[model samples]
Target: MEALLKEAPKVNHHLDHMPNMLVCENLQKVYPTPTGDYVVLDDLQLEIKQSEFVSIIGHSGCGKSTLLTMIAGLNEISGGTIYVDGEPVREAGPDRAVVFQSPSLLPWLTALQNVLIGVKQVFPSASKAEKLEICKYYLDKVGLGNDFHKKATELSQGMQQRVGIARAFALKPKILLLDEPFGMLDSLTRGELQDVLLEIWQKEKITAVAITHDVDESIFLADRVIMMTSGPYAKIGDELVIPFARPRNRKEVLEHPEYYDYRAYLLNFLNH
Candidate 1:
C-alpha cells in the first residue's frame, strides 16, 4: 500500500490559490438495509478550485457515482454537506448540470429542441434569439452544428452524446458533473469528444468533476486525478496532480516523462 501511494505532485500555483468552487466535507452516505444499515461513504473530504478539472477514479463499487449524484443534488447525502461557490447544496439547480453515461436526450425532440429545453430552464429571461444562439454555439462547439434539427432517435449514439454535451455547456453552469459521459461510446468517438470537451472547458473555465473508469481519460483531461478507496466506506485514497500544461496536446501528454509514473501509481492502487 505504501509503494502504491506516490508523493503528491507539486501543486500549480495558479490553481492552488484559487477559491474552491466546490467543497465536500465529512460527507456520509448510508443506505438502510434489512440487515441494518450499509455505510457507503464516510467522512469523505474533497475540494475543487475554480475552473479546476478533476477526475475521480476508484475501484468498482467505491461509491464514485454516489458521491457525484449527491453533489449534483440527484441523490441524498445522509450526512455532511456539498457546497458550490460557498453555498450548501440542498437540491438540484441550474448552477450544476450533469452529463450521464447515457446522453438521455428526448427522442421526439430535434437535437436543437433537446438543448433548448435546458437552456430555457436556466435562461428564462434571455430573448428567444439569444437562447437560440447559445444553443447553436454550443452545438457547433460539440461538432453537431449541421444536425441541429435531427431527432435524437435519428442521431447515432455518439451524436446523441454530443447533444448531451452541448446541452450541459449551453446552461453555462458554475459546476458540471459528468458520470462517465463517454462510457457508452466507442473508443474513437470517446477520444474525439474528450478533445471537444477539453476545448470547451478551456474556453468556459467552469469547475467540473467527472467520474471515469479510464485512467488515460482521467489523466488527459483533469488537473487533478482523485483516487477513492474501496467501499463499503469509501473516502479519498490519494490525489495526483497532472503535470502537463493545458491546452493539452494528446501526443505530448502521452509522451510526458511523468505520465507512465502517474499511470503506474493509479493502477497500483486499484490492483493492490
Candidate 2:
C-alpha cells in the first residue's frame, strides 16, 4: 500500500499532460409523467480528467442511467451543462461512445458488421480495408477474434456484451460511458470483462465513467467512486478516492486490508 501511494505522483504526472475530458456542472434531469413531474437528479457536478476511470453507484431508480445518458448527450439535461474538452455537449457524437446493460446489437448483423459500422461512422474517410482492420483489431482486443461472423442472436449474453464493448472501443472515442454494462452477467464473467476493460482503458488512455451497483466492481476499476443518494431527487452523496495502485489485480486487491473497509463504507452509505 505504501508503495502504491509512492507511485501516485508518477500517475498524476502522466495524467496532467492529457486534455481536460469531461465536466458536468449543476446537472439536473426531470421527466414529466402523467401524474407529476419526476425529478431524477438535482444539482449534480462531476469532473473526469483524461484517462480517469470513475464509477458511480447508487440504489435502483437513483438516476444513474439518466446521468450517463446526459453525459453521452443521448438525453437532454433539464439544467446545467456537460462539457467535453470545453465544448458543451448538445447531442450524441462519435466522440463519446456508450455501452449499455443490454448488448443492443442489431440481430441481423454479424458482430464484425456491428463494429464496422461504428468504425466507419467515426472514420468515414478511411478505406474499406482500413475499417475492416479496425473492426478486427477491436474484436480481437475483446477476445472475440473467432466469433466475428456470428449473429447477435447466436451468441451468448456474455459474448453479445463482448461485441458491444468491441464496438464502443473500436471507435476510439474520446470518452467512454457505460451504464451497468456488466450488471446482468454472472460473477465470473463480469470479473473477466472488468479486467479486459481495465487493460483497454490503460492501453488507450480513454476517459471512462461507469454506472454500477457493485461496490467491488467500482473498487476494482475506478480511480474514484461516486455514490448517489436514492431518488425522487438524486444527487451525489459521497466521493471516495480509491488509493489502490494502477495496473491492479482483482485477486490481490481483494486481499488488501482496506478493501473490505472501503466496501463496508460504500455499503453503509447506500443503505442509509
Residue 246 in candidate 2, Cα distance off native in Å? 1.8
Question: TM-scores of all models?
Answer: 0.96, 0.92
Candidate 1 structure quality by residue, lDDT tens digits, 1-272: 34424454546567867999999999999999999999999999998999999999998799999999999999998999898999999999879999989999999999999999999999999999999999999999999968999999999999999999999999999999999999999999999999999999999998999999899999999998999999998999988888679999899999887788889888877786
Best by lDDT: 1
Q: What is the C-alpha lDDT of each candidate?
A: 0.91, 0.87
The TM-score of predicted model 2 comes to 0.92
Give the C-alpha miss distance for residue 52 in model 1, angstroms: 0.4
> Considering every candidate listed, which one attains the maximal TM-score?
1
Identify the runs in model 2 with alpha carbons over 4 angstroms from their true place.
1-19
Error of 2 at 152 (Å): 1.5
What is the lDDT for 28 in model 2?
Answer: 90
* Candidate 1 positional error at 97, Å: 0.6
